[model samples]
Target: MYHNTKLTGMVVYPNDPEYQQARMNWNPFTNAFPIVFVFAQKIEDVSNAVKWARENKVPIRMRSGRHALAKDFSQTNGGIVIDTSHMRNVTLDKKNGIAKVEAGIRVGQLVRMLAREGILAPFGDSSTVGIGGISTGGGITAIQRTAGLISDNILAVTLVDANGEVLQVNACENSDLFWAIRGGGGGNFGIITSYTFKVRTAPSKVGIFEIIWPWNQLNEVIDAWQRWAPCVDVRLGTILEAFSKANGLLHSQGIFLGPAAELEKLILPLTNTGSPIKVFVDEVTLLEAIDFWAPNEPLFDTQNTTWSSTWVKSSLPEDGIAAIRTFLERASGSESNFFFLNSGGVMNQIPPQETAFFWRNTRYYMEWDASWTDKCETQKSIKLVEQARLQLKPYITGSYVNVPDLNIKDYGQEYYGDNFERLRKVKERYDPENVFNFVQSIPPAHICDEKDIDD
Candidate 1:
């Protein structure tokens, strides 16, 4: 491959001293080494890197915060890595209630920046996660029930296509690409350089609550939570986590866009289910609540930590509470847990066809995750996740794209549902050669024959 000396960003080869540090990801479970790593400083630098990769016949993997659960999606054995971590510019329009944020900014930075202006954008729970990954995958946060997913608040996007052409996509221009990018998942479409988001006024005071029960009451607490949380006031967003008995606790926590007294009254059903060992509720500013929920963390903080492989599967809980309890009873390690994210309110107000995100009608988004420290326990832990999935298969309809799972066979329907074909068409139009593709990416429509399309 011929190197381009005119490129604006710094490019590092295997021999470079910085190469080792540049290729590392947040998750230590998988190892990815690329032929070249380009630290993009500007939008034009991304374009130049893409053109260089195409000419060299090398695969290109776009990375932002590098927090992807499915590590393989953002890594290639011997390809080019286009990292956008250096482009962290954010411009705000307070009067217009809009913010133009670069792809490299972390969710915590975006949240704090907006908080300074008494405004906010819907973001995920993890502060270290990248905005580019979350927005594209339909981000859900504590205020999601009120404000909707992060993707829903996006006004427009500036993308650099596979051919290295700059494209401005929005409702009025490049509408198909615009529609696909929102909740269509990243790494399938072009690289998003920046996002224009519609911001909302931050509430003066919000309620933050956490309640914990003994493991013996997991079933009762989960049942009460599922019936109450999703049907509560749209202003409240909550999550329930049932940890393994080794952890010895079942907890429910969330944020409410109101005072603590009002939030307590609404969540009484959950708190009253079992003898709660601990209960805490307080009224604080939105920023205070966010910090309490997910504290700010360093970017590359995973080294020397106990590396664990994680598998996640999502579903809409129905009559599966008993199955979930049974699965947890036979779970493998202390790190294993099951989570349910309340998902009604404004999220269900939008029709599924309105965007590529098709799980609007689900009451709650559920995830079953298992982690292990030792290599000997890896397969056993993964098997536990798979077994739990099999038990809940009769009730689950789809999975979340943010928590990608390679174990899924029919990923197209599982992730995109009926919108898969349309996404495929959009992929053909934007990346005809499948330049931006990976294991679970939307394949170009032409590549799938009639038989595969029918399936």
Candidate 2:
């Protein structure tokens, strides 16, 4: 059903050699085949692609860094895929501390460019992730405890709406669209061409802390952390990342932002709670720390792994921790444990209702992930993952929309929570025709009556 017409940007088809790379995303399980691919070069190219897809009744999939690991949400079989990779453009203004970045810019690329000019924007932990996708779905960064979500620093955005009209929106202009793009969801309202964000001076020195604890002592460590991690001062950002070790040891990597002596002071309580197998803390430049936190190289080649996330008020209770230990210990040990990123510092200081991101009161946001390369072990990983979820479901307040599992039956409850209705109204006012549609994308209020059944 897609038209073969080409606009300003180049178009690729299924037979093209680059098709495979174009259709690929961060999620290994997602392999899609769109009828055509638009390598969007300019803002007008994006608008033309949207208009073309709408007129041809073709489903459109918007992609930036392809970091969305969820299936269905960004996948479209035999549909039209709008590739934003070619639209890379960055403008930096040191005098005003503002940077205008095209949606296609990668986190690492942005950091490298800004560091040259003595400025940096707060973004996700990964370097390859595109600013476009992360900003729309509750962007949390290592510095989030100090600076808040990436959306919080956004000054304005230029979005090409469903009607093929480019609208420059911000707090003072097209405020509703601005609200939706901040935390509602990307690809639902429009294709953001560029975003203007207030940048800050990069921290000259940052401290990172890593520790490995025995599996038997996880409860003591997590419980102790639950009480102390949230109360840490705003200058120090901390995270309790739990993971299984290849050497048969369970590890908890704690990342901190401050001097080495200061980091030691913050982690002394955790060390006293449980003896760790190995503990290392050091100070590094902000750029070097970002490289240290970037995902490993082999990660780029792995496929078929599953990731899920949910926000929690505090550490999982004793019963919840016991359930997790049981699941991780008995479930083949192939799956990694969840993480409680401390989010109660500057993150909580922002009022819950200020922007679309509503987890301000929550002490921690947890990411449940299960990664495996063996096709046969998929079932084992999935079952154990579900077991972990079932145990922690009662304690979960909400899920991050970006890291959702397509298999989740009720998405509204998992992602948007109480803000679903308000998001629906924003969608109605901006994308009434559903021209900007994806498999699990939010629907406008007028059309939500039909789609709500699926939710």
Per-candidate TM-score against the hidden true structure = 0.93, 0.93
Tens-digit lDDT track of model 2 for 1-455 = 33563455888888989787777776677667789888888988988888788778788788788777766566588788777877779998888899999998887778777866767667566778888888887788877887788888889999888877899999899998788787787788988988998888876777877777776777788788778877876666566755653324555445455687888888788777787888888898776666766643332436466667787786677898787667656544444666677777778888866777766788777776667777897887777777778888888877788787666667765677777778888888988877777667787787646546366
Worst 10 residues of 2 by lDDT: 245-254
Question: Once superposed on the true structure, which residue ranges of model 2 sit more than 4 Å away at CA?
Answer: 1-5, 245-247, 254-257, 295-299, 330-335, 448-455
TM-score of 2: 0.93
State the C-alpha lDDT per candidate. 0.81, 0.75
- Candidate 1 lDDT, tens digit per residue, 24-110? 777665458889988899889999988888888889998888886765677778988888878889999988989999998999988
Q: Count the backbone clashes (under 3 Å) in each candidate.
A: 0, 0
Clashing pairs in 2: none
